[model samples]
Target: MSKTKFMGSIGRIFIASFLLCLAVVVIYPLLWMVMNGFKSNGDMLSSPFSWPRELNWQNYVKAWNRGVSSYLTISILVTVTSTLTTILISAWAAYGLTRVAIPFNRLMTTLVLGGLMLAPAVALVPLVKLFQALGLYNTYWALLILYTAFRIPFCTFLIRSYMLDLPREVDEAAEMDGASPAATFWRVILPMCRPIIVSAVVLNVLFTWNEYLFAMVFTSGGDFQTLPVGLTSLMSKNGTDYPVVFAGMVIAAIPVVVLFFASQRYFIRGLADGMGK
Candidate 1:
């Protein structure tokens, strides 16, 4: 074989090996956690690495009865509401920034994108005061509002980047057909931006589902807790029930994992397309 061909083969082998190792590293812990959920506390303690002798589904039942069900419901509600709100607002903002000739366009873009710089931690104190005064504290609206607000900047940045790469002729064509600005956006641009929109939805869903800090702080426990915070509470309350805790965690992780895998093609393509621009 030629020297260049030999080196190319070596490079491909090296990359494949590296990726195999990375996949194992990422997947093992999740598999272990799932296995642990099927174990009893004693079994897990005795043989952390061994397969469960018998799949004890009772742990999952106990977890569900103990509060995982309620937490799961709340999480789904918040994730869905926040994701929809964030995407709609972000898509509109991106369309305006890219397609519309709004006043102070550059300044508007700067201010909207500038939100990425503001850390969520820094706003916690003021947000608490504001929410309490507005009677939104300890309510679902608080989570809904915060999740949408914080996520909009990043989502907008992604959609806007993707929109910027779209051909301006589409806009002109839509206008020539006597479509209004809103009609053009809905019919032409938004449809063309499907990849990025799906990407943004997946990303936002992941964030809203897994988000703990705001979920914990904004809502008092019981009915309002999301999966992350609820998992912590489950751990604390059931510290001795390790298997149940594991089960709760497994339950929490399943949706996001499934969602990502289901939409992975669009997710990767959207990110690549957006970033390429």
Candidate 2:
């Protein structure tokens, strides 16, 4: 073989091996969690690495009955509401910044970008006080509003980048057909933005679903707490049962994992193209 061809093959092999190792590093802990969740506490303590002698599905049942079910519902509700609202508001903001001819547009854009710099930790104390003052504390709306508000800046940045790269001919063509600006945005631009929209939605879902601090602080425990907070509560209740605790974790993780895999293509493309362009 030619020297160049041989070098290229070696490079491909190296990249493939590196990716395989990375995948194993990411997936192994999940595998261990699943395996150990079925084992008895004694088995997990003594032979943690080994598969259970018998599958203990009851662990899942106990975990679910303990609050995983309610937690899952709360998580779903907050994730869906927050993701949709964040994407919609961000997409509209992006469209306005890219398509409109408003004064001080650059200043507005900078202000939106400034939100990305604010640390959630820094805002937590004031947010708690504000929510309590507004009587929104211990409510689902508290989480929904927090997730949407904090995420909009990053989402708008992604979408605005993607929108700036779009062909202008489509907008002109729609305008010649007498389409209003709102219609052009709703019907033409949004349809074309499917990849980034899906990407942003998936990203928002993962963030809101896994968020813990706000969920723990904003909501009084019980039906209102999301999966993360509820899972922590489960840990306290099942302090001695490691298997059951693991089962709760596995249950908590499945939805986000499914969402990521289902939209893996759009998620990667949206993030890459949104920034790359």
Candidate 3:
């Protein structure tokens, strides 16, 4: 073999090995958690790292029946509702910011970007009190609105950055054909923004799915509790049942994992586009 070819092959092998090690590091914990989920309580305690001799699949059924099913439903509702609303509202905001002439647009963009700088904990106390006074505290509306509010700034930032890259001619073309602004946005801009939209949807899904603190503090009762809060509550009640707890964690993870893989292509493209700006 040529010396250059030999060196390139060696470099490829080294990079492959490094990435394999990284993948193992990332995947092992998830695999371990899944394994533990199939163990009995006693097995989990005694042989935490070992594979179960006989898989106790009963924990999944128990966990699901006891709490996960209801909490999963709540999570699905909150996540889907908040994400959809955030995308729609943010899309419009983004389109307007990019397409329309507005005074102090730079200042407005900075203000929206500043939302990500504020810590949720710093605002939680006042927010809770505000919700309480508004009669939305401890209700789905409180959590839904809070989630949407916190997420909108980021979503607007994401969609707006991507929208800037789109050709302005499309909007102009639609207008020349007698399309209204709303019609142009819905029929022209929206269709072309599918990749970024998918990215926004997946990202928001990840945030709203994995979110815990807001759900815990804002919503109580099984009726309003999302999966993370309900799972934490389940851990409190079944502290000793490691298998059940792990099972609950695993089950809670499935949807987000499914979402990530389903939209993997667009998610990466969106991240690239967002970062490129």
Best by TM-score: 1
The TM-score between candidate 2 and the true structure equals: 0.96
Per-model clash counts, in order, read 0, 0, 0
Residue 180 miss distance in model 1 (angstroms): 0.5
Q: Would you give me the overall lDDT of model 1? A: 0.93
The candidates, ranked best first by lDDT, are 1, 2, 3
Per residue, candidate 2 scores C-alpha lDDT tens digits across 1-277 of 9999999999999999999999999999999999988999899999988989999999999999998898899899999989989999999999999987888999999999899999999999999999999989898889999999999999999899999999999999999999999999999999988889989998888889889888888996536999888877765543568898899999989988898899999889888888898
Task: Tell me model 3's lDDT, rounded to 2 decimals.
Answer: 0.89
Q: Give the better candidate number (1 or 3) by lDDT.
A: 1
Model 2: ten consecutive residues of lowest lDDT: 231-240
TM-score of each: 0.97, 0.96, 0.94
lDDT of 3 by residue, 94-122 (tens): 88888887898888888888898988999
Q: Best candidate, lDDT-wise? A: 1
lDDT of each: 0.93, 0.91, 0.89
Models ranked on TM-score: 1, 2, 3
Angstrom error at residue 109, model 2: 0.6
Candidate 1 stretches with Cα past 4 Å from truth are: 237-239
Where in model 3 is the C-alpha error above 4 Å?
A: 1-7, 236-239
